[model samples]
Target: MTWMVTGGAGYIGSHVVRAFGQVGIPAVVLDDLSSGHREFVPEEVPFVQGSILDTDLVTAALREHGVTGVVHLAGFKYAGVSVQRPLHTYEQNVTGTAHLLEAMQSAGVTRMVFSSSAAVYGTPDVDLVTEDTATAPESPYGESKLIGEWLLRDQARATELHHTSLRYFNVVGSGTPELADTSPHNLFPLVLDALAEGRTPRINGDDYATPDGTCVRDYVHVADLATSHVAAARALSEGRELQRVYNLGSGDGVSVREIMTAMAQGTGIAFEPEVAPRRPGDPDRIVASGEAAARDLDWVMRHTLTEMVTSAWQARQAR
Candidate 1:
């Protein structure tokens, strides 16, 4: 079955597209290239350069590609920036998702795997967030994702759409040296970029109650994340039952200090990180249990922290 991968030219989307190719699944790419690089898309895949906001363009792409399923990944993704650009975030994520769903309906495409975020949970008080965790999104980016899920649910109730949203946190690492995380806001990229520029990476805060006094978060490799997306899409295509959402997370988390040590070891940049004040609203820790996803979506953290840093650093240097 052929699938349409929105934002397929992006770092994470490109990895997902590559995973699909490796598994012998036919796929086409639809991306506006606002944040994605055209070069990230493979030469052999059909590429449609357009925004998901355009229902006509989306519908046409789905029809033209004979897309049986869609993996929605295109959206305004920066949580910190989303706070400053709430309207832009909603327009791109919430409205864009609605338009894509509408286009899917028009094109008779009924299966989808939405690339959601753990930001939907905000700063959960729970030690290990489960699928049943309350969704109290703090940023517009998170809120938009939650709304997108709601739109999919409502549409599913009214139509033949079968879908699942994968909520994940701090995705890192590279599946291939050619495909790397380029997000400026992500921890790995930020640190790697700083080191490449001969600047010391700074820790946001080191006064939290955690072991190292820095924040703790679940970090998953991008390739493992991509495989789970493929599994989710395949499940939907094969009429397998799936929950409305699943958390792609590591039950045990690594602290920001641990990441800093790993980065220094992986990059051989033995400089001490500058300690800075905590960014407002920063939680002490946020980790989720991937039990649901592991059971249904083939979720797994296949890369160690050192491997994540090394692969990411190597990719950044290559770029």
Candidate 2:
């Protein structure tokens, strides 16, 4: 059965698409190209150039492709930018999800895998965040993603829908050199971009409560994340019951300073990162336990932190 991957032309989306193909599943790409590159999508795979906000186009694509399920990843993903542009974030993530669900119902597509975010946990007051962590998102982007999950939950109760939402932390690295994270807001690109340009990479702040006095976050490789997405899709397609939500994390916390250190080793660029004032809404630390995901979704951290940086650097250099 064919599956439609919304935002499949973007970084993480493109990796998920390739993972599905490797598993012998046919996938079609539907991306607006807002933050996605046209070349990121494989030429062999079918591509629909449109937004999930366009219900009619999505419905037509689903019906035409005979798509039996959907991997929903399209949304406004920048947490910091969402603070200043909440309305735009809502329209893109919340409204876009509703519209996608509407189209799925119209086309009788009953299976879905939603790409959620760790931001939904806000500042988790725990050593390790879990699926049961109380959701109290701080930014509009996080709020929008939580709303997206709710929309799917609400819709599933009323219709023939089998769905799962994956709430993951910072996603970095690349599955292939051809598919790089092009998000200007993402950390891997920002640090690598600065280094490539002979500019000093800047760490947001160095006054946090972490051991290194910088924010500690969970960063997972993109390829591992993509494999898990496909696993979730397969579970849904096979009529296996999955948790409503899962946390795909490393169960480890890494500070910004540590990331910078890894950046230097990975790129062979020896320079101290400049420290800047902490951005608003940044938490001191947030890591997650992937126990549940590991048991169910075949989740595993196959790539080390150094591998993450080096792979990301390789992709950046390829671009």
Candidate 3:
């Protein structure tokens, strides 16, 4: 079945599109290119360059592509930045999602897989986050995602729509050298950029209560994440039952210091990272259990920390 992938020209979205292609599914892309690169989209896929905020454009794209389903990934994604740009975040995420859902209804498309974030948990006190974990989002970005899920749920009750949201932690690495995480705020890009520019990467606060006294976070390879998205879409298309949400996370976590070491090893930049004060609101550790996702969405952490770093570094260098 053909599907429409919002933000399909983006790093993560492009990988998801590629995964769909590998599984012999035709996919169309809708992206405004606000943060995505047009080059990331494959030549064979139909690309509609427009924002999801435009109901007419979204509806036309869905109709034109004969879209049977959607993978919603377009939105304002930076958590820290969303705090300062709350209105912009809501407009892009919350409002945009509403518009897309409306367009889907207009086009008679009833299946979707929403690309959500782990930020919805907002520094959970638990060592392993489960699907039942309390959602206390601390940022507008996270709040908007939760609200998007709510919108989907409310719409599902009123219509024929079937959907699932995939919440993921730190997404790193590359499925191919042609595509890389280019976000200035992401750890992999920031560290790779620093090393490429001959600057030492700095660790924020090495005095936490965790092992190595540094913050630990769940990191998953982007390819694995993309595969799960495809699985979720397929499940919905096949009328398989799915929970409202699933966390795509590594059962264990990797510390920031371990990341620094991996970066050095991967890039062969042997300089030690400088220690810096912790950023405000930074949690010491946050990890999630992917048992639910693993069972339903084909979730798995297929890459090691070293492999993640190496793949990311190689992609950055290629870029």
Model 3 Cα shift for residue 115 (angstroms): 0.9
Q: How accurate is candidate 2 locally (lDDT)?
A: 0.94
- Single out the weakest 10-residue window by summed lDDT for candidate 3: 297-306
For residues 85-115, what per-residue lDDT tens digits would candidate 3 score against the true structure? 9999999999999999999999999999998
- Candidate achieving higher lDDT, 1 or 3: 3
Over 4 Å off in model 1, which ranges?
A: none
- Residue-by-residue lDDT tens digits, candidate 2, 1-319: 9999999999999999999999999999999999998999888999999999999999999999999999999888988888999999999999999999999999999999999999999998898999999999999998999999999999999998999999998899988888888889888999999999999989888998889899999999999999999999999999999999999999998889999999999999999999899887788999999999999999999999999999999999999
Model 2 misses residue 239 by how many Å? Answer: 0.4
What is the TM-score of each predicted model, taking all chains together? 0.99, 0.99, 0.99
What is the TM-score (0 to 1) of candidate 1?
Answer: 0.99
CA lDDT, candidate 3, residue 284 = 87
> Could you give me the TM-score of model 2 versus the true structure?
0.99
Cα lDDT tens digits for candidate 1, 46-79: 9999999999999998998899999999999999
Give each model's clash number: 0, 0, 0
**Model 3 residue pairs with clashes:** none
